[model samples]
Target: MSNIIIGTAGHIDHGKTALIKALNGFEGDSTNEEKQRGITIDLSFSNLTKGQQNIAFIDVPGHEKLVKNMIAGAFGFDYVMIVVSAAEGIKPQTVEHLEIINLLGLKEIIVVITKKDLVTLEQLEEKKEQLLMFLDTFDFEIKFIHEVSIYEKESIEKLKNSLFSINNSIKQEENFFRYYVDRVFSPKGIGTVVTGTILGKKIELNEKIFICDSQMESKIKNIQVHNINALEANISNRAALNLQGVNINQIKRGDLITKKGHIRGFDGIDISFKCLKDKKLHHNQTYTLFIGAKKVEVKVLLFDCITTLETGYATLKADEKLYCIFGEKIILRNANDTICGGKVLNPIIDPMKKNQKRRLLEALDNSDFTAAYKELLDAHKKGLGIISSTQRFALSHERAIEFANELENVFVDVKELVIYPMETKDFIKDFIKIIYTKNTYALLSNASINLRLKWASTAFIQSALDELVNEDFLTRDVSLYKNSNIKEDFTKELETVFLHRLKQEDITPTAPYNIYDDLDIDRKLGDDILKSLTAKKQVIRLQHNLFIHFESLNKIVKEMKNIIKEDGFIDISNFKTRFDLSRKYLITYLDYLDNYSNIKKVENRRVFV
Candidate 1:
């Protein structure tokens, strides 16, 4: 069975703690400070069992100065019981606590009028009327209202029955186990112990848990639910866990203990904010944000025009990083007043520019993940957009491929997916435009393409290029690539000029730079022309800055093979004499032959393979 959490809210000395004791038949306050001061300073927990249902009561401090403690204690409450004294009626703290409860979005409230024995029947009737008027100003609906005097045993029994009736109607959540650390201490013989109300799934003994937003890991040594030894603790129940592999000093209030990889920490977050009253919120104003058991200082940046009680988008930049998930409700407070509260839309880095903010808002407004994914992709259309597997909107590799398949003609790689709003065919068309505009023959090398498109990974580029080649939009020849429709009208002219220069040299090919100067073409264009000829098998690039006509190289190979066949091997001097070539060209040709398996270089001689 799921546990029901009920929190008490009201002024100090108003019998909030006394009424708790009267209902459960035991004192909720276990500290000497609370007894000496005659008030609750921090949160105190107690469990009341009626039949099969168990209700957990969190008694929060009612002093105005301890309002932060009050907010912390009311983090995960399912119901709130407002304690108002019949003699005092409505006090300042009573209104403040009601405002906080409304801001927290808690809908169920049970007003308990305490100190009833101290007032006359007429006065009690008047007090009830005034409390009703006070509650009418808020949005929450009251579940039940009852008069209770701790001295009266019947009134206490009536309140317990009312609690049991409400427990049956509260809905339970089935989210993953998330327990906020409200108290961390070391008990003798137990090592480190953490106590908090479990807000999510059941936690079992020996379960590995991570301290949220931190790199600390601990295992549950034992579990205790409502002071009973248990193997597992159900959701909404108060639990004390004996933790192993962590020290008591390593954690504190507001740190979360949850299953690893279930949530991530973010420094900035976007929220849907609304003020409770006609209060103007300024940009860059610092406020305290209360979510779960954590309180973080955040600076507000409003996206829409500022107005009173208006709901709009805003970004909250925390002074320190905090861990939260989407749809988590947050309460914002100034130093003195509770201003507004809202639900988290996204938790991520800040959008630094107005355009990025617009894109983010548009993406968040979409109801489906696919639309949001597309908007994010459009925002980064100028380059590759990266979304890691750990992000909230990240799809699995299989799901990403499904999205790609759903969208026609869109290329996506599982290892490094790239999403674009335009079709992959259009992307190739644009890439062809770049290649055609830069070179006369509409050709580009892989290295050149990588330099122009630096944002894309090599894997993504290779995948896209292969898709374009399969689609007959481009052609690849060894290391050089070109558009399939490119005419290459100047290819023959460039090839004729290159071969003429090679022939002009005596027994050696001319260096590429000398040819570039002789032809009066740019070095890059010259190199592209030479690489194009080499790709077509019309020329052989023997080494760096060396080229030979393919036909002439083949004739030399035939003569060297015949000489090796007759003599078994040919030394460097003999090879140079046979070809009438210089030492540089002869050595380069021999290495090229060795590389192609046409000849084997054994020691200082070349042998026919």
Candidate 2:
């Protein structure tokens, strides 16, 4: 089935709710306050399904004070229905609603002139002409204009059929799913439930979702579309999801629901904006930013201008993190007055110079991702990660790789999703050359080198190591690489040196890996040399990573026996009384006493046989 969200926009008492009641028999004003005031206050949701088409209606309040509520619903609109009363023609709230929707990029418009019974035929035609001329001033394509009254059932049915006749609005099949919570409540017998329009992608019945604001994960316990149970909900469908693990108090309006790791929240984001009418956006001034049913107070910082700008690129810095994606629309308002509308250009904050940021924002605004990639590569000379392209540029992994391939003198690691300027390889090559020059006995591997250069991937390090091998500067033995100049095997020399070093420490010896570093030998080679010494009886393996020279072990055993002879029984406490040693050495020494059958164990103490 196809789904579309159609939102109503107009002045107060323009019959937007009455028309919905006439068409689908849904009374939008469900609250006691709304019933008493006789006006729509908050957003009301209802749907009409005919055949295979489902059209969800979002009835927004037309009161000027409720414009914020209107904006919250406008973000999910696929098409907007502009309701203008025949008697009132066009009012202040009507013009403001049109301007806001136009700023939000709503192109397809359905003009509904209601209260037709209140006006004569001649007056109706004049009003229709006036509405057309007024709408033509903006950039919306007028799809249809209908005259209807709540008393006329025939006109209501005709309008409903016309709505279904229109082609289904196109919804981009994005890879990630997200929905902003407009209403959260826990029904009696049910768990926490949130209602909003599904966007970006479809959601399944039992899918796990992350609440961005609360930083928690919840499962979909149930799925409801327009009060009917469903197995799945598609993009643009008004859905109510019963969440399993969270309470209703934990969620509020504007909390984002999406798959984990698909989004990154930022306190600052870049955008290209234009103020409505003659309004000017001042730099360093705070404004309410509305996007995806969420509003945050932010200070605007113009990129190219100093004080104020009527239209241009700027950054919105909020006290709290804003989770948004590329090309998402945003509205800036001062109190209740709408200022400008913009599209999110850069949702991820990049640590770049002001000039570089301006250039990147320009490239993004023009949809030139190649320039943006180059700008990022220039700043991230070490290596740029392509994995963030999904949230940063709205490009998939394959598409990001395709863009990387188009760049000149760049190395693209598709497996690791990192892009580096070819010149970065020289740094790795130079660093490796110094290591070998300083110590001809040094043996290195890709994994060992990555320990020093954590930012460089193993694959990248291997590429540099390969270049060294080609240049005859290094030779590889399976996975270990060593200086090619030293051809003869130095295994015996390394074993003698390490065994002596272990004997010097006597009881407390450094870890094998650390000893390998001090002697400028590879870790694997050091392990091999220690094993050879152990086989020759010159070294004793004490623990998993500990090795002691034979002389040191024999001397420690004699000292431990003296302690037992002096104290009648030797335990950790008595041993420490004679020799101040760490727990590792004391425990290992006590356990090694078992090698002599002459010593008898009595619980935690050892005594003579």
Candidate 3:
């Protein structure tokens, strides 16, 4: 079945809720406060199904003070039903709602002139002409202008048929699933259940979802679409998810649910904004930001100037982390008045200079992703990851790679999703060359070198190694790269170097892995060398990581015996008093005394046997 969300917008007491009830036979104003007040207070949800077509209705409150609640439901709308009363014609809230829908880029408009029975035939016709003229000023496809009175059943059926005839569903073709929570509640038996429209992709039962605000993970214990049990829900389907591993207090309206690692939150985001008619957005001014059902107070900082402007680039500095995607629509308001609307350009915060940020935002505003990538690559010289392309640039991985391939003087690691400036390759080459120059017996591989340069991918490190091999600076022996100047006896030379280095350090020797790193050799080869030395008794192994030359062990044993003779007993404290070494060395040396035929163990102390 195809699903579409249609929201109602108009002034208060315009029959928005009654029209919904008449069409779907579902009561939208279910709460006591709403029933007593005879108005829609919060967002109410209902749906009407015809064959395989399911049209969900999000009945938003039309009161001026409830505009925030209206915006929360508007983000999920594919089409809007403008409810206008025939007696009053167009009102202030109607104009504001139309402007907001236009700013949100909603193109489909279905104007429903309600209460036609209350107005005379000529008066209703005159109101229809006025609404048609006003709607022409905005960009919208007037699907139809239908006059309806809830008292008449034929009018509601005609409107319902017109809606069911919509064959096209505006669904986002994204690979990840995202749902914005609009309503949250806990039942007596069931756990926390949240209702919202499925976006981006489909979500299946038993799938794990991540809550953005609480940073918690929950599983879908059950799924319901329009109050019908289902195993999965697709884009545009109004779903209620019974979640496990989270409390009702943890989730609320405006929280986001998505898969792990699909989104990265930012405390600030960049956008290209245009103010509403006759309104100016000032720099460094705080406003209420609404996106994906979430509303936050944000301070707007215009990129071009410190003064007020009608349209430009800006950054919204928010107090809380915002989980948003590129190209997502945002509504800005000051107090209760809708000020401006914007589209997110950069959802990921770039740590850069202000001027660079401006250039990047300027390029992004123009949809010049290549220039924006270049600007970001300048600051992320180590490498820039394209895995975040979906959230950062609204481009898929393949599309991002296509743009990356168009750039010059950059190395694109397609498999790793990393893009490095060409100069970074030279930086790696220079650093590796210094390592080989300092240690002629250095033997390394891409994996070993990756440990030293953790920021660079193994593919990037291999590229640098291959470049060195072309220049005859290094020779490849399978996966290992050896200095070209090294002799065939390099293995023997490495073993001798290790032994001599151990003797030089005497009683305090570095771990075998550190020795290998300092000498710029493969860890496996270092292990083999240490094994050969220990097999011949040329070195002594006191602890797992402690290895010492035989002569150094003998000398330490002699010094320990002298301490035992003077103190009549020697333990870690007395051994440290003489050698002034760390506890690791002191304990190892004192334990070695037990191997002596003349010594015996005395609890925590060592004495003559």
Candidate 4:
């Protein structure tokens, strides 16, 4: 039956306790001091049940010293009972308490006129008129108000019925759980503890949550509401919580401990606010700004008091250190107290401002995804980059779609807060593509001085040369990339291969394609091909691919002949294997090797001379 908490508010000794006793048939003020004085010093409570709903009455002290106590009582109440004495009518405490309610953002309230028996018809009418005048200036949206006298029997029943109806009329808007800290105490056996009304839902034990922006996490150890050990507290109910792993020294009454990364702390995003009409607001004038459990004095930069505040509208800033990120509603008070205020743009970030574009843009440049795309495009214009969308948006997928749109020129698709630009894929296969065209099919020796470039990539030049065979750029016989028939002025190509291969294994050459993989190529065909000089004896061919066409194989043959004649036996296999040439090509030039009269081929791979 415990579902709603109804609080009584009015001047001191406004028959608040008497009224509660009449409603629930119980004395809510149980303390000796309060009983002796007939005034509620601390918060008093009683429960009235009808059918299945339980309504607890909170009789708060109307004294000025007890305003903080009033706040504690009101923290968990579902609906407020604004009790005004019919005899005394409206008072200072009534207005002050109303201000407190508005500050806390209470929405449901019912006005109760008590002690109607003490006033006459004309007197009651006059008091009601005065109460209406006061109530008209307040901000809350009240559903209904009624008159009742505690001295009459069933008067409490009448108020209880009204409260029950009002409670039924109320609805809780579903949102993430938020508990406003009202009291912090040390419980027996348990260390530091805090209490507040359960804002919404059931909290599980051992759940870790953040204390606003401190980034510190606290663990929920235990909970209690109204001296009851509630296994799980629901919304609109008061509760105490024992938290562990966080020092009470670090936590204060206003600290909001919540799930990490749930709420953003506010900062210097300029806001539009409605100031009190009579308050003088000058640009750059500093004032106190209170935003949800936090407050500071900020300067007013963009505001005009003459611009018609309508009692609750203005845009201003904070000159002091404070944090209330976004989607948090805030109030603007001058050096003097007031509650004129505004709401944030969204829950994720401070609303962007025009005046501080440079600073905001700087953060955006470092963070905003779309702006990053623009930077990416600029880099493309400079032929500079292909940066990731994650790097562009700083990896905060909160604004991922809008962040991806920033890279729209390239194309963007977002999934799971990840940005994958289309440009990233566009270049994957077509990267560095170049079209090679000719007037007609080119011969291996006829294309551009008989030199075909397979590729320009340093990592895959040899593969690209192999690719050239696929592309019909060169013959399949082109083992070395330099197997081109390209004619060049210098013998550098073959000579470089010779020097490298000779330095590698130094096997005597018998052919041209004597490539050992360990021997690195220093060959560049266009500039390094070895062309025979027809005017001089600069070429020789000892055997097959080992040809210097200018000496026409004679001088190399003579060298081979001298070796065989002088040594009595020749090792042509050693020379033939080194240049990868066949023995037939060696024999065709063997007479050129001079044979010294006899030539015999050995089956065990020997050369006979």
Candidate 1 off by > 4 Å = 168-175, 304-311, 350-352, 355-359, 362-374, 380-470, 474-609
Global lDDT for candidate 4?
A: 0.54
lDDT, candidate 1, at 593: 68
- Candidate 4 lDDT over 1-609, as tens digits, reads 447777788889788888877776678678788779777786665667677677767778888776556655765567778988999988878876776666556667888889999999899889988888877787777767778887676765676677777445242523346665655778677888876555545566667666774567788887766566767766766567788876667666656655564454444554444444455445555666555434456765543344333432234554423434333455565543553555442222223343343343333424443453454343343121122322223233444455455555443323323333334333321221222122111122223221223212222233334455555544433433232333342244445554444333322343443332122222233123333322233444344455444333455455565655665655665556434656665655554534445666555332454
Clash pairs for candidate 2: none
Could you tell me every candidate's TM-score relative to the true structure? 0.68, 0.95, 0.97, 0.53
Q: Write the per-residue lDDT of candidate 1 for residues 513-534, one digit (tens) a residue.
A: 7776444444676788889888
Q: For each candidate, what is the lDDT?
A: 0.75, 0.91, 0.91, 0.54
Error in Å for residue 150 of model 1: 1.6
Worst 10 residues of 3 by lDDT: 166-175
Candidate 3: pairs in clash? none
**Per-residue C-alpha lDDT of model 3 across residues 106-223, encoded as one tens digit per residue:** 8898999999999999999999999999998998998888999999999999998998888556766677899999999999889899999888889999999899888999899999
| Candidate order (TM-score) | 3, 2, 1, 4
Prediction 4 TM-score vs. true: 0.53
Q: On a 0 to 100 scale, what is the lDDT of residue 9 in model 4?
A: 84
Name the runs in model 4 displaced over 4 angstroms: 1-9, 12-51, 54-78, 96-107, 133-141, 168-175, 267-271, 280-327, 334-336, 346-415, 418-609
| lDDT score for residue 235 of model 3 | 90
